[model samples]
Target: MCIGIPGKIIALHPQQADCAWADVCGMRREVNIALIAEGDRQQLIGCWVLIHVGFALSKLDEQEAQETLAALHAMEEVEADVAMFLGAGEKR
Candidate 1:
């Protein structure tokens, strides 16, 4: 399954504004915001976006982004538990 992470646009490219820097899960990375509307793009300096495969699929409200982040955190917790269990039990 393709996972899309919610992030906030922190910075934009000076020369080519197609791609901008986003703060995702506490980490900053370059993301493409070309898919969104030009009006929105023009004022996306502090907006949340659904980042998928290095591209910004769409813009999201702060509330929605927080909800998605909560879900993602829950899923991550489950994955970490599974990894720990697998590591504890060695394969033959």
Candidate 2:
């Protein structure tokens, strides 16, 4: 399934106008912001964005971002539980 992850804009890339650094769960990655770029890039710092395939799809409010992150974390836990169950079944 295709999923968009929420990330916070950390800083604007020095040489790339359409690219910026985003913090995704503690990891920083270069994300293309051309789709949502407007006005001053500095203003985007601290803003949350929905990212997909290295591109920032849209800007999200802090509350929405946090909710999405929480959902994603829940899904991760579910996946871990499923994996453990399957591993146990294989040992049977």
Best by TM-score: 2
Query: Which whole-number lDDT from 0 to 100 does residue 44 have in model 1?
Result: 90
**How many residue pairs clash in all the candidates, one count each?**
0, 0
Over 1-92, each residue of candidate 2 has an lDDT whose tens digit, in order, gives 57788889999999999999988777677889999999998999999999887899999999999998788776876677533322221111
Error of 1 at 26 (Å): 1.0
Model 2: residues with Cα > 4 Å off, grouped in runs: 80-92
**Candidate 1 ranges with C-alpha deviation above 4 Å:** 40-42, 80-92
lDDT of each: 0.76, 0.82
Clash pairs, candidate 2, are none
Please, what is the TM-score per model? 0.79, 0.83
lDDT of 2 at 25: 73
